[model samples]
Target: TQGDSGIQRKGIILGKELARSLGAYTGDLLAMMSPSVRMTPLGIIPKIKMVEVVGIFESKMYEYDSNLAFISLSSAQSLFGMKNRVSGIEIKVDDIDAAGHIAVVIQKKLGAPYFARGWMQMNKNLFSALKLEKITMFIILILIILVAAFNIISTLFMVVMDKAKDIAILKSMGATRASIMKIFSMQGLIIGVCGTALGCLAGFTIVPNLNKIVGFIEQLFDIEAFPSDVYYLDELPSQIQYFDSFLIIVFSILICFLASLYPAWRASRLDPVEGLRYE
Candidate 1:
């Protein structure tokens, strides 16, 4: 385990991306300089010291991976001439989900002159952007469901046109108008249910293997489809949330049900006398 300053007497830990960029490895010496100047006999000069690289940390985020470096608290304090003070405190909580609440508590306890901030509050903008992107994608993906609903609507209309005589016969034989409506509605519901099931099946089957699928495509095309340098990620990321999936399925079914309403109503309103006359 390493401390806040990240400096050790033996060496220092550098961010993985920074180390890679510098072509440095363990045991390699890295010179660090402070902007603060020290007085010398000749003139003022920036303070500089060389330290060995002991380890590298991978944070996965490009911003942190490329920029952050760690040194020990004693080394940092000595180098910066800060005797017994720290800029901030880092706290780890048992439940990450309660970080916001905990931060508030800490802030209250610390009171004026000091404030506690959670990672969520610190990175609120980035998370907000991600949330917005997710919502936009959700809206765009919903078009596919709307298209499927349209298909259901057209199919139900065609079925009702074809079965007009049968519907009229059923109505004359004691089936109520509401029952006729339900029959077509159920037909549409069955189509929607089957479609939703197949979609969920395909999603579950493919999402887990999406990385492999991308790799195959890249190999087939002899191209780097997602370059790590450009994307800042070695591989694609995929997450499956059951609640999100359930919401999508429910929304799709609701759209399908709404689409079926007009067609089913039309089917129920067909005059039995006219339908029988044509037959």
Candidate 2:
């Protein structure tokens, strides 16, 4: 309706981007060639038909917008000289997440001659690549946490050395080696807990406002950090999953606990006499 007044018997609809690129408008006639051949005086030639443009649609996705075209099923069949036959059927499901399951059921019902495929099956390679990329990024980020854990280990070891004299006095006052170990381990655990909480807080606060932050930085520097034309999006997109955040916090704390092991063991094994030799 937006293009031509109504869908004519041989009407075709063009994607918005395709229409723009071809400088075509509603009520304009476009010629399309079919793969089937027609015999003519000169020789065999491809079948051709001139169809009126009835509508233009926008899908937002660049690939689909620039490439897809549509026409009535009957018109399509007639153009290809396959009257009364359809190449495929499109089905809409209420639950998109169960599309694969539904596709399986459809295939089972259709049996031998027909097959059904879900969108996920149709784009398997793209999803697999995305999954691999996610795994690689996760491993890389985990390395950063490991590096921080090492820093924590060094800091705790320094603290243990500085408090050696106090530890010796505590031991002389009847503090057990187990109690000394517990003290150092608890101190390390407290540090890990605090660091994890702060990191989570900062992540939650920053991720949602990342686009705004980038915009501010761009304004300050007078440069575009992410150009809309190149990226095909007006702003950067980010999502914070609670489950992922929980896993990160757990992993960081686990690493910190492991890092504290050597330092805590060394502090607990310190002999009172050796620790207080110069005191």
Candidate 3:
């Protein structure tokens, strides 16, 4: 790690094999310079120095691949001439979900000198836009379920028309108007449960291997892999919360129940004399 004042080169950190791969090893001199550019009367001067490699470290991320150099905090601070001052500090919370509350607690604990931010707050704009897009996509996808519910409505309405005489006979036999409603409601519930279950199953089956599926499609279609740069994530991310799944199932059932209303009411209002006479 290089800083403004000078550099700290030799630090025994990484082991032998890694150092050899990086073309660096213990006792090898490494040079580092401060990031600051000073405009003197003569010209812009950059502070620079060299250090002997004592150790090396690696982080799995591509951003840190082959580029990160480790140095002592004291060396960094002195080199930058930032006496007792740091550009920023990183904090990690035990539970990521509680980051917002933790950040607030930290701010309060530390009082006025420092400001704290959570990961979500730091990425608020990006996450907010993603949330909006996801909601819109959900609404659009739900139309598929709604359309399926309409199919239930159409099928039951036909059954009502075909069984009008039976329904009338039931009504005359002391099966109250509400009982007639229950019959059709049960039919609609069956269809809704079947369709929602199938849809949920299909979603789960596809989501787990979505990346592999996309890779195959890209190869077959002769297109590039999905754009990782734009998306920031390497693969599609799907977080399946059981609660969310339950909400979807409940919502689909409601759509189906509501769809049954008009047709069921029509069946309940029919007169036994008129229905049987027509038959």
Count of clashing pairs, candidate 2: 0
Please provide, for model 3 over 205-224, each residue's C-alpha lDDT reduced to its tens digit, 9 standing for 90 to 100.
98888878988998999986
Question: For model 2, what is the C-alpha lDDT against the true structure?
Answer: 0.87
Candidate 2, which segments miss by more than 4 Å at Cα? 1-11, 24-29, 42-45, 51-56, 210-237
* Shift of residue 204 alpha carbon in model 2, Å: 2.1
lDDT of each: 0.85, 0.87, 0.75
What lDDT score is found at residue 24 in candidate 2? 90
Q: Which candidate is the best by lDDT?
A: 2
Q: Model 2, range 1-279, lDDT digits (tens) per residue?
A: 267545678988887778989999988999999999999999999989898889987765556667888887787888899999988988999999999999999999989899999999998987898799999999998999888888989998999999999999999999988889888888888889999999888999999999999999999999988764465445788999889888989999988888887898889899999899998
What lDDT is reached at residue 263 by model 2? 90
TM-score of each: 0.86, 0.80, 0.70
Candidate 1 Cα misplacement greater than 4 A, ranges: 1-7, 168-175, 222-232, 276-279
Q: What overall lDDT, based on C-alpha atoms, would model 1 receive against the true structure?
A: 0.85
Candidate 1 lDDT by residue in tens digits, 1-279: 222234567478887788889998887898888777899999999988788888888877667777888888877877787878887879899999899999999889989999888889998997898899999999887988889888998999899888989988998998988999998898888888888899999999999999999999999999988776677676889989999999999998888888899999999899999778867
Model 3 spans > 4 angstroms off: 1-35, 38-42, 48-75, 83-85, 141-145, 164-180, 272-279
> By lDDT, is 1 or 2 better?
2
> Candidate 2 — worst ten consecutive residues by lDDT sum?
226-235
